[model samples]
Target: MFKLTTAAAEQVMRAAKEGGTEGMSLRLAATQKEDGAIDYRMGFDAATEEDIRFQSEGVDIVMSPEDVPLLDETVMDFVEIEPGKPHFIFLNPKDPTYQPPADA
Candidate 1:
């Protein structure tokens, strides 16, 4: 399951509304590259049958089914870095681990 915070949802919804497209929904999707790395993309006024629409705080974020796995147990957060630099950050529950040093 994916989680979208109120702030993130609002910002996305506002942007979509300003795009002046009817029935437009924010879409979030990810794809596996040739190197097996997953990448994410966001769009406004874009959607497909394969996309999953997120509804919260009167806002929606559409995502493709293929991108579901990559978004599993993920959470979206809003952050203010410096001035006039608000951004969204995706957090995954499953993070890579680092190996511990061997006993000397």
Candidate 2:
């Protein structure tokens, strides 16, 4: 299953409230590229019958069945990779470009 770090959850919650999507799930999708890298997309959306739904860090999330395998064991995080700027990052081990966090 996919998970979100505390910072990511907080950011998502804040964005949901600001975007008037507070009750919607955070929709996630991942597709593997030819070279085994994963591409990710996300937005607030309503869950459909075929969607996989779960809660992580108090935030609701939805993903299609097709994305399950690609996102399995993935973790989303919000961090300041560069000074004064924060970004959302997917730390997916399944991606060939993935490297374990140095701090871990």
Residue 47 local lDDT, model 1: 66
Q: How many residue pairs clash (N, CA or C atoms closer than 3 angstroms) in each of the candidate models, in the order given?
A: 1, 0
Cα-based lDDT at residue 42, candidate 2: 98
- lDDT for each residue of candidate 2 in 1-100, tens digit (9 for 90 to 100): 8999999999999999999989999999988888888999999999999999999999999999999999999999999989999989999988999999
> How many clashes does the backbone of model 2 have?
0
In model 1, state the lDDT of residue 41: 74
TM-scores of the candidates are: 0.70, 0.96
Worst 10 residues of 1 by lDDT: 93-102
Off by over 4 Å in 1: 32-38, 95-104
- In order, what lDDT does every prediction score? 0.69, 0.95
